[model samples]
Target: MFLRRLLPLSRRLFSSNSSNDPASIIAELNKEMESVFGEPPSSTHPNSIDNNVMAAQDSQSVSPKIVENDYGLTHVGSKGEAQMVDVSPKENTKRVAVATCKVILGRKVFDLVSANQMAKGNVLSVAKIAGINGAKQTSNLIPLCHNIKLTHVRVDLSLNRNDCSVEIEGEAASTGKTGVEMEAMTAVSVAGLTVYDMCKAASKDIQITDVRLEHKSGGKSGDWSREE
Candidate 1:
């Protein structure tokens, strides 16, 4: 490719023979090239090609920006592979997270659960237990979650007559290098699932929705909360 592009310019420069000065010849050659090719191609010479390749390799050598947040999937290695985060270097600190979810049970199932008439037993009590257990076992459930000792776990369930749903709130606290966001979320999720399992007999149309972290505190990123 280099030879093909250079052949025309070489013929035109030597044919002119107007000046034997190497500097002037080189400058004319460059002007002719720009007129014919508009821009220099990367394959102009072996050294230019090597320089471009080196520049690309240098860019790849730089560590990529990795953002850890609710909108991004983290826990990645240098080679873009999945890997667990290492928090061993971090200092232990108190962390707290709150998560919430809602289980839509319809009017009939909601009333039954509210009145403690479900055949599977008291829905709220069993779900609360399940939520606490789930918070403790968060590391086992999530592949990349750290197994930190939880200081406390609380699960609250309330009947929402307006929506005919059970609102579940889970709170988890820990003194560890990593935050307990996943644990709190796991608690709310498990509680919602237990609510469905206990009341599925009454209505299979039950839905679990709005599972999300409401607030998190005491991390390197500081604190965060949902906007209303």
Candidate 2:
């Protein structure tokens, strides 16, 4: 929720609902900046090649040097500083990411949901809408994420009788400098949460599990897909 959207006086009214507070928005933007620029190439070394053997080796292989920024802590700098990644130099490309989640429910609850028999109405229908809304709200919720123009967002929900569960999948696509993995994951999260919130009346034992990125494509790192 964004204050700009919540307290909109003009055309930008009520945008980014997840960032409803001003202080939070500033903090989020600052955090994102720190994450983006936290790392730089520590050093550049020319490679020596043996023409005959066609071998190449790094000249600065052993000297103590600043290590590359770890993905686990992209927000922290080599010197323990925070920075915003400069995306101006990055080329915009079509990026897509998919995430999945499973919601396990009791037999009674599962049957009720699959048949849309719950008093709360169509669970999957509401969840799909919630998932899309969640994807749109990802930037606002995440502290270090850019407000991306989403080209496409799709959320699928299927009742799995064999597993006594509901399978949820969310796919997000954008043509931008960064990937949309968070958006996809957020979609699945909200969809699963919606199911819990809606079906809690039926049973409180519902479990959400295996929330993870299933696939991603585009960007400099290329593509990745989870195995099983």
Candidate 3:
């Protein structure tokens, strides 16, 4: 039981293959002695069995690197088809995702929306509603997306007059097998598009950019957040 408790720690401190090699195991023990006593082992040392045990302990301390391969489909097949991820056997779990998008419009268009002078009427409110609707319908728009029930969806919009841009944020939550990252991203994208549709009459220079997932939680790999 004590050996089991110390095994993981030992593996982290020595070379990766030291545990399998007798000579390397002995060297590891000698190195630990040098560290603890600040001196080399004596040539006349008579306790061979103790020395071997110490060597094994030292060998167990080496650290190993974890390597993972990219599983995403990056190339089209011979028949011009894309590969989809297989999640058939994965257990269902709760998941949430958040994403953001920015729409940069001309100063005139921004001012028109801000002042409620656009002929379309209530650009921000319409976009927010569209975003929520989009979140609910994301699986329909994107192929291979699992159609799971969304427990909640929220969309927030902010105006940056100084930069003539509208920032859109979307959040989606679900209790199912897959994550909602794509849904959140799709919400922001559709919302930005709606803004462009409503305000296009005011200015034709609107540009939607930076549609991306901000954070996600729950799943086998655990949680993740994109760096700012």
Top lDDT hit: 1
The global C-alpha lDDT for each of the candidates, from Candidate 1 onward, is 0.91, 0.85, 0.84
lDDT of 1 at 10: 84
Q: To one decimal, what is the Cα RMSD in angstroms of model 1 from the true structure?
A: 9.6
Ranking of predictions according to lDDT: 1, 2, 3
Error of 3 at 17 (Å): 82
Error of 3 at 214 (Å): 0.8
Candidate rank order under TM-score: 1, 2, 3
- Best of the candidates, TM-score: 1
Poorest 10 consecutive residues by lDDT, candidate 3:
63-72
lDDT by residue for model 1 over 50-123, one digit each (tens)?
A: 89999999888864653223334558665566789989898888999999999999989988988999999999
Error of 3 at 182 (Å): 0.6
Lowest summed lDDT window (length 10), candidate 2: 48-57
Candidate 3 off by > 4 Å:
1-84
Between which residue pairs do clashes occur in model 3? Answer: 10-60, 10-61, 11-60, 11-61, 11-62, 12-61, 13-61, 14-61, 14-62
Give lDDT: candidate 3, residue 25.
67
RMSD list, candidates in order:
9.6, 29.8, 18.4
**Model 2 over residues 152-195: C-alpha lDDT tens digits?**
99999999889899999999999999889999999999999999
